[model samples]
Target: MKIQVSTELLDGCVLALLAEKDYYGYAITQRIQQTIPISESTLYPVLRRLHKESWLETYDESFKGRNRRYYRLTKAGTKQLGVIRNDWESYKHNIDWLLKGDNHG
Candidate 1:
């Protein structure tokens, strides 16, 4: 069964990817595909939203005879990533505890 991925989780993943290096839409989608099952349609809006939020910056580079827009994380994006990481950590901890049937009083 395919599990549903949340929007916040998707945003965090995209931010983390951009944190590593700038990538075009296709490349970002490909990299994300390695770990999660996401499509171009889903990723494009995320990119647009991030850019609109000032968490991401874009620049176009001439590749061969075409232009490719690349995305990079901004200072805000890095900070956002940090927040997401912390949230994920806490969430995972709680879930793990619940799954392991460990109830501490």
Candidate 2:
């Protein structure tokens, strides 16, 4: 069964992607889909929220006569990504321990 992803996790994922390089909204969605099952529709709001929160900055570039908005991580976003990654590691460790019924993760 596929488990539903949380908003925080989604935000982290987006931040991680942008940490590598800037991406347009559609490209971000496609890159994320390679590892997680997420829809384009679902990602826009995350981008909007990040942009609104000042965690992300955007610039529009022309591509094939159309302008595509590209997202890049800000200093705040980098800091947030570090926090999320730490939380994820802790959460994953605990969950793995519970699932395996062992002390090791």
Candidate 3:
């Protein structure tokens, strides 16, 4: 049986946050929970991967004398969000039809 969340889910969460703000790792970790709750450990790797792939960009800021890495959507990331959001909508549409559950999603 297919189980566990997919990497696409990780990408979706990242795209959602990047669309919202330039967030530090900790802030991204927290904001992602609003929709897709995931652990700090799980998130760092995904964020790293996205940044490495050039889909996301990172910048630093001084907050209380500490430099923190922040993540934001690159042009690529913004472009990908449109594609991914369409895919997600189609997936949800089919799933909703089959399940007939509340459209809380």
Residue pairs of candidate 2 with colliding backbone atoms: none
Candidate 3 displacement at residue 48 in angstroms: 0.6
Q: Rate the local accuracy (lDDT) of all candidates.
A: 0.95, 0.96, 0.85
In candidate 2, what are the lDDT values of residues 12-105, reduced to their tens digit?
9999999999999999999999989999999999999999999999999999999999999999999999999999999999999898889754
Where is the poorest 10-residue window by lDDT in model 1? 96-105
lDDT of 3 by residue, 14-48 (tens): 88778987889988888877766579999999999
Top of the candidates by TM-score: 2
Cα error, candidate 3, residue 30 (Å): 0.7
Model 2: lDDT of residue 43: 97
What ranking emerges by lDDT with the best candidate at the front?
2, 1, 3
Tell me the number of clashing residue pairs for each predicted model.
0, 0, 0
Any runs in candidate 1 off by more than 4 Å, and if so which? Answer: none
Q: Write the per-residue lDDT of candidate 1 for residues 45-80, one digit (tens) a residue.
A: 999999999999999999999999999999999999
Model 1 TM-score (2 dp):
0.94
Candidate 3 stretches greater than 4 Å from native: 1-4, 101-105
TM-score of each: 0.94, 0.95, 0.86
RMSD over all Cα atoms, model 1: 1.3
